[model samples]
Target: MKAIIAKSNIGGVITTPPSKSYTIRALLAAALASGQSRIFNPLVADDTEAAAEVLTQLGAGIKRQTDCWEVTGGNLAPPSSPHQKLNCRQSAATLRFLAPICAALQGTSCITFAPGLARRPMTPLFDIFQQLGVRSELTENSLNIHGTGGQFKSNEVSLPGNISSQFISGILMATPLASEGLTIHLTTPAESKNYLRMTIDCLQRFGINVEYDDNLEEFRVEHQAYQPTDYIVEGDWSSASYFLGMGALSGPVTVTGLNADSFQADRFMLNCLRRMGAEVIINGDSVTVNSSPLRKTDTGLNEAIDLLPSVACLAGVSAGESVITGLDRARLKESDRVTAVADNLKQMGIKVIEESDRLTITGGTPRGAVIDSFDDHRIAMAFAMLAAICGDTVIEGAECVNKTYPDFWEDFQKVGGKVSINE
Candidate 1:
């Protein structure tokens, strides 16, 4: 899939898509509830679909509706026939969240991962699972676990802060079913604390109380039932950041349907945009950005790491040099995003310096160059936004957006972006 994006300015209003992070959290949280639950404005993307399918196979009743999804879930019933295989479809969240839940169920289960996802690290969370008496065997691209089909062995689980927050969330969601409670101690000061905040939000929304200190060094949760409730998914700040980046260089772009108080970590992009001199307007649930004197950035990405590609793209067109830090976690994503962003920027004749944990981009007028997305959705979207100012831009693997936003191209076009597909 190739996308040819020509230089143009986008204007008018486009509503941001619902958050994939929140939708998946809602699905997983709902699956543990004892009764019917309604989730409104859920994101129906590849990743969220993977979560839904896995939950369905776990014997949860999931029904799609016009405006929401009705989920009836309680105890998971092992697929009537034994030895059922589930494909996680390259979603890290799906794999991480499901692994621990399957262990809590104490049932025979096997999960297969897409080829590209096989190499993602898992031992950190698995170590804790093993501590809870969940036995697992790892082979290439798949995980086979024998779950006790009930509460885990109550114990203190310590995890490093650098890994994906999904690790913390996955365990937090599953430990409540254990015979006793569990305490999560952060061995290092927790990084990406906002993602954990989202996890805590989900847990509390489902009627599970979480105890944590101000520093977020420790968390304690006991065996508790997840109560079903009506929930609404919020607009994704990560996805919306792309358009806001475009708005900084282009004109009159406004994204609606976002929550100002969202726990979604990417919401911090608004502050960064302000720092870079983009005119941002927050009216009700929508945010509008207009042309401004965009400048270079110096910010930490510990929490908003997913915004790296977009923010880096914004930096590519700014007037001076920009430095972004805290990218060590980026290497573990679907693709080595840090390297991918740096390489693609270099391809476009932009001056960039790539390091293991930081990126320094000297913003100037960039020329369009053929770029590969490295099968990363954010990379494709990031460069797409950058294309508006470049001489010409062609993005391969453009369809990767389906992982989070299936209609990304259409939405881009809707906002007056001059984009065409070359298939």
Candidate 2:
């Protein structure tokens, strides 16, 4: 689907969607417990659905309801049929977090991935499996894993922390089910440290404990069991960024249902907008932003790489040049976000300088142009705000937003955005 945008004023109150990261973590944790667990306000999107399907294939019973999901877990077994494979459907989080869990099962397990996920880096996690005496075979689109069946040969493992936080999270979630306690040593400082912290927080909700040092370079997990309980997913700050950017560029927009003290890294979007001289107001769980003349601010996105597309668009209309560093890992996301952002901005008559790990965008009066979303959700949503600022902007592959925020277009319209959808 394509979305055509025209210049217009947008302002209103729209609740943020539930956090996808939290929903997936809660689902996996619930599936690890012995009793049935209830997950409330979960994000019912494609990625979360992929995780739920894989969990069901692994012997967990999941029943979906209108407002919540009931998951009965702790009796996980590989599919009885040899042809039955766990398919992750382009969700890297589901694949990474479930791979290690599958390695702890008794029988052999086969996992398949979509073409896009096949391009992601998985060697680090694969190496850790070898260190733990688990046999794993990897191909372009499929993985064959032979499990230790909860009795890993080795308990100590080491991997780089800079690659993907999901690797660390995968290990942390699975190690608790091992026969012996496990220790993980990080080779480098971890980027996106908040994500790892979020994983530990989710584990604690299920009665699992994780210990780490100040720098977060080392982690220790004791062999334990998960206790089933009701888990509630919080609102996503990542999804709120697009609307907040719109408010800064257009008018007084308010986003509700967010926890101001969330550990989610994207909560820093509020700070970034404030740094750009945008008027921001916080009233308990709701945040309101008023249109202001933005000024360029230099920053690093190492911790919040997902915000690259939205922040880049914000910089495109600011006064001075903005430089965002620590984007080396952003290239490994659903798309080459750094390149996609630069290319889209250039097409909109903005001056942008692109590098391997940084993007320098000079603010100017952006003119509307056709935008290629790279079939990426963040790219499509981020460019939507720019489209509202400069009319006649058509975003190809607008349907990609269903991967995370399924109602993004509807919410865009509710906030008074002038957009037409071409299906």
TM-score list, all predictions:
0.98, 0.99
| Candidate 1 displacement at residue 230 in angstroms | 0.8
How high is the CA lDDT of each candidate model? 0.88, 0.93
The digit string of per-residue lDDT tens for model 2 on 181-219 reads 799999999999999989999999999989999999999
Residue-level lDDT of model 1, residues 1-423, one tens digit each, is 899999886887888999998899889889999999999999999999999998999888899999999999898855656667777898999999888878788577888889888777888867887677778888898888788865566568888877888888888888787767788888888888888899899889999999999988788888889999999999999999989888888878999999999888999999999989999999999999998878888989988899899889888888799999999989889899999999999998889999999999999878889989999999999998878777488999999999999999998988888988988
Single out the weakest 10-residue window by summed lDDT for candidate 2.
146-155
Best by TM-score: 2
Report how far off residue 172 is in candidate 2 (Å): 0.5
Ten contiguous residues with the weakest lDDT in model 1: 77-86
Error of 1 at 390 (Å): 2.0
